[model samples]
Target: MEFVRLLLLFLHLLGMGMLVAMFFVQRRAGADAPLNKGWLHAAALQLLTGVALVGLAPLTDQEYDHAKIGVKLLVLVVIAGLVAMNVSKPKPATWLTPTLAALVVVNTGIAVFWT
Candidate 1:
């Protein structure tokens, strides 16, 4: 189980990297550029890994602060929403990439500093 958790964590980090890279790539390429599939895949990966990680750890109100989980989950949902809204576009809105990157950073901050 720990091994699986670690693997998921690894993939989660990769997904984050992909998302951030997508933003940089988008910045370099123009709003009219076709969407990159990698960004959407990363969003999905983060969602899946994050849920699995919670299940693996099983945070309880009595033990760990579940509020942090809730907050993170909400942020993840927002990120997922962003991905869903932009995934199929031939050319995504100019705001999507930077917004996605900012949201991901916020999520990361929540994960690290929530305790």
Candidate 2:
């Protein structure tokens, strides 16, 4: 159970990194390029690993603040929503990438400092 928890945490962190990287990737693709699908993929990964971690907490004898988890989940949902809404478009709005990046940073800060 400990190993499983750690593994999920590792993947969750990786997903966060992927999102951060997508910011750079999107920028490099130029303003006219469509939003990258990687944003959705990374967000999905984060969502899944996050849920699994919380759902398995009892079995792992871990205690978590439900309120904090709820906030993080909400933030992730917003990120995913934004990406889904714009991914199929020819080009994302000028505010999209930076907004997403800021959300990601905000989520990280919540996870680190909310305790």
Give per-model TM-scores.
0.83, 0.98
In angstroms, the error of model 2 at 20 is 0.5
Q: Spell out the clash pairs found in candidate 1.
A: none
lDDT of 2 at 112: 100
User: For each candidate, how many residue pairs have backbone atoms clashing (under 3 Å)?
Assistant: 0, 0
Please write out the lDDT profile of model 1 over residues 20-81, one tens digit for every residue. Answer: 88888878887788777777778888889877777777532123458988887888789778
Overlapping backbone residue pairs in candidate 2 total 0
Best candidate according to lDDT = 2
The regions of model 1 sitting more than 4 angstroms off are 58-64
Deviation (Å) of 96 in candidate 2? 0.2
* C-alpha local distance difference test of each model: 0.79, 0.97
How displaced is residue 83 in candidate 2, in Å? Answer: 0.4
Local error of candidate 1 at residue 102 (angstroms): 0.5
